[model samples]
Target: MSPDQIVVTVIGLAAIAFIVWFFWLGKRLGVKVAVNSSGYQEAMVLVKGGYTPDLIIVEKGKPVRLNFLRTESAACSEMVMFPDFNKSAHLPEGETVAVELMPNQPGEYEFQCQMGMLRGKLIVED
Candidate 1:
């Protein structure tokens, strides 16, 4: 095998490992999750574009999981926001990546896409 072939193989395996680990850790954490996407006209209104379940409620200690469901061919859904935790993740297109946020205090944590068009709120209650 050539060096290029070996590198490609390694990269492929690494991607698989990352995916496996992502799902495994996600499930193990027992994160409370909600799915969102810009599927139709009504649904798009909630996210203002391509986000769904824009309004979420959870306990202070509980982790909030946003399974960013991207249905478009382009890579429009790039990142998410959790201002309370100061956390953000760059979401890849056509993938369901998860983001976990643990809000210690009871308040509303807001999130939006990079473009600021898509928005959501996490109401953390005590």
Candidate 2:
């Protein structure tokens, strides 16, 4: 291939890779967890690339307590926001932060970092 063809091929590959990663990352990192006896569904969410185990599954009409531990110092993961609940929290480096909420409806609730790069979801189901 010529120099221009090589460049075009490289760019095309990069775009395809990004598209696949962007769509699959969420499902790849998702984890379904049940609340423990202590009434909390806990997970350690790594914040470097995004929230690990981003998808959290739970029963509907029940109060949910989520603990997020941010292990990275990236500014993009400094804070977590739950727009559905009107909740936002600052996550200090290397600490576990708790978010308590009562989700009475069966739906998908989204959470993300301040810059919206790190993303998470709570799937409330029957």
Reference-based TM-score of each model: 0.57, 0.79
**What are the lDDT figures for the candidates, one per model?**
0.61, 0.80
**Model 2 TM-score relative to the real fold:** 0.79
Give the lDDT of residue 106 in candidate 2: 88
Q: Which stretches of candidate 2 lie over 4 Å from their true place?
A: 1-18, 21-29
Assess candidate 2 and give its lDDT. 0.80
Q: Please, what are the lDDT tens digits per residue for candidate 1 over residues 36-119?
A: 353211112122254666666666665555556665544445677666677877776566666766667888677887666676
- Scored by lDDT, the top model is 2
RMSD of each: 14.6, 2.9
Per-residue accuracy of model 2 over 67-122 as CA lDDT, tens digit each:
77878778898899999999988889888888788888989999998878777788
Worst 10 residues of 2 by lDDT: 25-34
Give the lDDT of residue 6 in candidate 1. 100
Q: Model 1 off-target regions past 4 Å?
A: 1-48, 73-76
